[model samples]
Target chain A: MKKNRIFNTITLLSASVIVFIVLAALLFTGIIDEYNGQLLTLAGIYIIVSLSLNLITGFTGQLSLGQAGFMSIGAYSSAIAMMNFHLPLVVSIIIGGLVTAVFGLLIGFPTLRLRGDYLAITTLGFGEIIRVIMVNLETYTGGAAGLKGIPSFSDTGDFLKDSIIKFSWVYVFVIITIVIVNNLINSSPGRAIVSIREDEIAANSMGINVSYYKIFSFTMSAFLAGIGGALYAVYFGYLNPVMFWFLTSVNFVVIVVLGGMGSITGTILAGVGFTYIQEWLRFFKDFRLVIFGLALIIVMLFWPRGLMGTNEFSIVKFVRKYIRKEHEGGSSKPSKIKGVK
Target chain B: MSVMEAKSISIVFGGLKAVTNFDLKLGKGELVGLIGPNGAGKTTVFNMLTGVYSPTSGDIVLNTSREGHNYKSIIKLKPYQITQSGVARTFQNIRLFKDLSVLDNVRIAFHFNVKYNALQGILRTTAFYNEEDEITEKARDLLKIFNLQDKEKELAKNLPYGEQRKLEITRALATNPKVLLLDEPAAGMNPQETHDLMNLISFIRNKFDLTILLIEHDMSLVMGICERIVVLDYGQTIAVGTPEQISKDPKVIKAYLGEGV
Candidate 1:
């Protein structure tokens, strides 16, 4: 057992090192230029938010339509800290997440008692309320005019270095978010959370605290969304209340549903895919949104359960299956081989 | 000593009284059956005892063997808290977590007892692995008892109906309850299945040293295994005695067979 553990650790470390080197090579060589880097950074930010939202809606079976509200809290607070309190960038981002978590607990506690549609409506209202409050807080938030000239990643005055720094924060965070979310889903508390999604009353009778998990996931989700927001704020070097509107919140819900609610790999795929598609469709001008809408409808029509439908796509499992098949069926036709999962 | 007792519990919803002045005592290692016709509030009584509904006017005291903690007032407590107080129950409809694996359904019952917090869980700490592996072992042991060890990987919803019912019981036992309340375990079972389930219930009552309160419409099941039977009609207790006495009671007969007969 100890030998296997050590081997696994070695494999993971080497894999991480290889991925980091490859990504750095791409960025430094200007193979992934400024525009693509910016788009990828945005996609990574969205992926983090989607993963967090999955913790609440997919695993815990709670409908929350106010993710963008948490994001706005993170952005504004982080921006405020950088400009007003003169904190370092990382510390500001942490403040953003912590502040959003506090709001998550406060809002999630009372509203979570109302299940199903009631919770959805309450969260929808919450998203709008946060946006309206941002518009009115003229002093700190800059109200309707928005907060501008926030610290940018381009501190070295070189465009490539700026994009690299931004993408690095996003890449590291995307990895962190994935690790944490996957770890949570595989553990004991994760079982309790998923059990609640399966059947609340049954989970309760089986000694799982239904409400506590609901609140915990909501807070955890809000914290991650805030981190995404902080990243967004730094990427653009600006904070805008208009960016975190009701539509923004609903957009994430759409991504989560389209990605396959509980499937982490699907969310990452959809987040990056949609971001790339939207950015690349700039040639269509106003027609881009129509294409986007058509794509969503087509995907849903074909795969009603969304892209992955609670099934994860694991690269290791895929690789191992083919390797084992080759050893067992050496003379078998390659044409006879089927998709593993 | 009684493991759990409901002292004249009553609950009213607006103008209607769902359960009226209901009293039950579950002595240690006793297997008691609650029998009633449809709409007689048998489930309501179970609901009240499990803290799904707080009695409008009564107290439910559950005694625990844990040192220094003799009894807990389960009245007005959340359902999970009631389970934590050593009372676990299975539903009439076999409410297993359908999407989860059969093993997970049982493991979830061990949630309250796990010492590691969410941070430890997310961090993959040593304590988390120790507790998680222990839970998996314990849940597998429970599955072995129900002969569900082979089907542990199958989704709970994909299991055969009889196995699903058994899985529900296994899950309840995983909570380590002193008192186990089973609502209609034989609802959809065939005669052979029902017979096997009754034997299983008796086996667990002995193995786990449990006090069981069961609700069933199956007369033979009630009379064959139950040491005592409580009969209810129209939200009121019509009879309470051994199966022989309950079988002879005029009130129970009237409730089951009706006035013309």
Candidate 2:
């Protein structure tokens, strides 16, 4: 059994790496093109933040409506690091995540004590407060007028190389984020977090630190959201207070809800799927929100548990089932024919 | 030799004296029963012992170790800390993590024993896998003992009613606690299941060397397995004796009924 587990792990990792290399090769070769690369990077960044939200809301069972606030903090912090201090782009991105993590801890400690709707409202208020602060801090942040002429991934001067470079950064971060989230959910600390969401009282009596795990999940989520924000800043080379609005926060939550809560694979699919759908719906111009709203309502009405319903998409399981069916085909077919006769 | 002791513990909710001057001493490897009419503070005493509710007066001193030494006042400690200090409980309503698998339920309860940090867990360090593998091995052993090994991968809520109750006990025992508090363990079982549960309780008590405090309305099972019976009435200890002595006590009769009989 242990050998099988090790084999499965190796296969999964190698498969993911191979797929990444193939895609990166395509991007570098210019076959994916700049426009499609931009779209994929956007989808990748959104997945990072959605995974962050999933860590808190889906796994930890805490409703947080202030994720966009953390994202904005990352965006501004990383932008300042790169433009002002001339720090390396990597360091600046990390700085964004670290600074935003501090804020996550600050807000999480006070707000995590509240549960359900109260926590949601507190987070919503916190996001608005961050946006307000960004709008007011005109000198440091460039305020509501927006920060422009920021350093982007176009350092190589060659358009093809630059697009690949930026896409690689996003893709690498996406893989890193996925690994961290996946590993965290399958471990002991992850079990503790989920148990808190299951039954706080039962979790407590069973010797799980409910509050500490809640804060831990919250902080991890904030860090990831910050990373997503940093990626956004470098990708667009521009920022505005209007960009990280309440509606932006709602978009991520909608993806999480459309995916199954607590299903990591489901959230990734929904994040990437919803991003493309939104981009396509841009033809509707200003009424895109109406379309999104209707889509959400219809989805919830049809499948309230979301796409996966807490069941993960496992390639190994599907392949095994398919193989077993093929092996049983001869005997099963004869039995079915005999019964029919 | 008492693993857990409550010295004149009392708790009040608003103006009502929910449980007044209650006391209990659970000896090593002994099974005790707490019985009372509905709302007679049986569960309130449980709440006080488990650190769910702070006693308005008195102290709850737990041994805090497996060797029946290192007694400490657990009254001021948080519920999780008290649990770590060697007490574990199962809820009356069977609070299993419904969405999680049966094996996952037991493994989660074993979380207190996990020594790896979050970074190690995320990194999949050797130490993390070692501890996690140990937990899985132990959890499987526990489920096998409860005869639910076949359904370990099934969601907890999908289990039959009797098995769900068994799974709850299985989860509590996974903590490897010195003291186990069962809140109405036999609340919703048939005679056969309750009989099996009675045997299971006694079997585990001996196997784990555990001191048990069970609150139950099942008279036969309680009288059959418990070494001592503590009867409560209106937030007070009305009687404390063997099953034979408790059955013949007039105060207990008065509490269970109205008057002359």
Candidate 3:
């Protein structure tokens, strides 16, 4: 057990160092231009979006399509805070998440009682309703024209004010999002949440408050999506109802399904990969969406469990087995497979 | 005082009486059995006791302090709330969380006992780590009691039939119930497994000081372990007495082996 703990620490340290090195390289060497940097930041935001959705739809087995609604709430709230209240970027982002969480609580209470496709349709309706509200509320949200001139992280009187956009800000938020989510997934409440998905009757018999956990998961998912929205507002320096249409929620659902539901690493990888693919498919012009639809269908047909299914890829277990084999005088045979029984 | 009591509890489904005027009293540390023929509402009785279906007319009360309080009626409570109030039951058909690990099947029952909250979990506070580690160790220990320690990492669905039943009982025990309800626990088990299950049931009754109410089709296993038995036929109690008296009762014999047995 002690050896395993040590191995976990080593694996975590190595992974952190690798991410730091890559980000530092990108910053120091001008290998990535402004467009690439913007895409990377978008990828980071989607990582937050996908991971949060995974907690609700994947782990808890509650199919939701209202993510864009929560994101719009966050984006608009953060933008309003900055434009009207003149709050710091960080404070406004936090406010955005909290405001969206409140909305999640209100929507989740009434609609979470529905199951499966009914729940999905209800959330989709909620998403469209939020968009309509944003479009019609011209006085506060800048109407159908949308809100503009939202300040970026670099515009917050920071050291790197000369840079067009700060990649580090998004990177740090991505890291924080990952840590918070990974921690929740491995905790006691997380076990109850997953058990509800596996078997609700059994979960109830075992003393799990199913309704409470369902609401909790939905609320948390909205909270994170709100933060993602805040990031989007700052990244683009603008917001519009059309930008958060019902199709936007469908896009997030596609990313989550194609990435493999319930696997954080898979969602992160799929978020980045799908963003890049969309950018690359821009050459197709009018045929872009057709190709995108075909790609989704093909991936679903070939890989129904998505990229990772329900299994997690654990670096610590991989490192531990390798170290053990080397210590025992390594043979040509492979170390035992880990993370799956 | 009886650990659990049901008085005149009845449930009707659209004018069809599924169960009617059911009554039971389970004493502390006693192992009781409920036996009936197919479709005799044995499982329905268990369901009502556990708050699965609220009795349409009558009351169900729990006398034990399993929830750190004394004597309360659980008829209005939800199923999970009933479990929290010290009544835990296994299903007639095994309802294990099929995709979860065997250890997780037991660990999830211990969820209410864990001291940490969501904020602490997300923050990874010291209290969160301590409680999680403690619960994991406790779950392993509980598995050891059922001799399922070796299968801890196996998914619940992958376990063999007998082991799955044992795991179900182990999970029910994990809830630390004042009364443990077993619904057809020895069903589909071979003679050898049935015999082992009987001994295991008696052992846990003594070890955990549990008031056990089991619904079983196996007469010998029921007669062997249960001090008293309640016979049901057409959703009504035909007789309630010690095993010897119940076996000789005419109604019970008619209910089981027809008139001549």
Candidate 4:
């Protein structure tokens, strides 16, 4: 018990230490201009969106291709509230999340009861509907012209001004989200979601209200997506009807699949990696999507469980391996096949 | 008083009467056996009792007024609601969450009793931690009861077939049901496994103070564990009596022996 407590304390201390260092580095990284900082903020937004999709498609074993739709709901709702009613940014974000959650429940009530492929198709239809509506509702939404002058709450100020980059808000939110999601998946309810993903009929017989939990998962996922969308509006200070197209929803799925569907940290890592990779390949931006398509196909074929599978790489495991290695006098590296653990 | 009473329960699917005029009564603390040939509607009876399918006609009254904090009838209740009403059941096909750990398989089933909200969960507040610790301890206790404590971290799919069957039962019992239903509990077991499973069932019933209603094809196992047996063929109860009486009943003999009676 003492050993376990020490291990836990050390883990917590190290995690905090790592977070503090990262924040300090961000504060000192003068090379990162306001523009680059904003991009990082966008990554944080996408991180939330990607992780939310992971809940339904990754953990719940439901094929949901409609996260972009939920994000749009959040974006529009939060953006409109701030732009029109002049609501506080935090309140707008909350409203966005709530609105998206209600809409999620509305869609989930009837459609989530359907089995596999049917649900996928239904959610896909919802995504299309959201896009079409955003495009058509010219009076309220400004239609294809898009909404603008979103509050620039996510912008980083000049370092000389003694103002920490508001970009840290995005980073903090994303990191907290990652931690919470990880903890949730490690918790009992999270395990239930995984069980449902593994086998729905089995989950049901185990006294899991399969339908209720499925819808619950969808609702929570949409809630997170809405939160991300709200952050996106704040960070980008602009929005367009085309931002929530069906393809964007598909792209989020691609990101999750390539990252390892059920891994929270893996999703965050892939969100940052994929976003930066796409931005960096902007010179050949036309081919950017082709590469994205290729990455997903290859990941599915070669590493069907994706880059990290569902297991997190932790220092605890490393320490264990190191101890074993010291006793045995062998290198700590496992075989590639065994390393999948 | 009987805990679960079903009267004239009938279900027809298109031209076929899948279950017809089946009557059953399970008293408190009774272990009842339901046996029949293939497609004898043994599972259909379980389904009706658990509210998976409402009977086309007839009534199912499952009185859940043991203490009367807030008692509700199981008849026409949702499947989960039936669980809350103290009726829990296992499927014939050994349904289990393959990816989740065995302990989690049972823990998640206990979510009905968890009193924490999403905020508490996200924040990992005092109430959340308290509830979580209690849940973990309870889940571990349950795994120990099933002799699966060592395998708590192992995924459900990794366990052997017989162990998986036990885990399914463990998951069911986690709901704290007053009455438990075991559908074809010995379906895929070998003879020795079936014998041990029979012992396990009786042991669990005694330990958990459960009223068990079991459907099985293994007549010997059911006959050994159950004090009373209900024989059904073509969705109709051919006989209902003690095992000794059921073995000698002319109608049951005819149902099994095909006119040899």
User: In model 3 chain A, where is the ten-residue run with the lowest total lDDT?
Assistant: A332-341
Ranking by DockQ: 3, 1, 2, 4
Tell how far residue B149 is off in model 2, in angstroms.
0.9
Best by lDDT: 2
DockQ of 3: 0.55
lDDT of 2 by residue, B19-121 (tens): 8888888898889999999999988888888889999999989886677488899989889898888888888888999999898899898898899999998
Kindly report which residue stretches of model 2 are placed more than 4 angstroms away from their true locations once superposed: A25-33, A316-341
- Grade the docking of candidate 2: medium
Write down the DockQ of candidate 2: 0.53
Predictions in order: lDDT:
0.85, 0.86, 0.85, 0.78
Which residue pairs collide in model 2, if any? none
lDDT of 1 by residue, A73-99 (tens): 999999999999999999999999999
lDDT of each residue in A156-202, candidate 2, tens digit only: 78877787788788988987898788778888888898998788898
The TM-score each candidate achieves on chain A is 0.91, 0.90, 0.90, 0.85
Per-model RMSD to reference: 4.2, 5.4, 3.8, 4.8
**TM-score for each model:** 0.94, 0.94, 0.93, 0.89
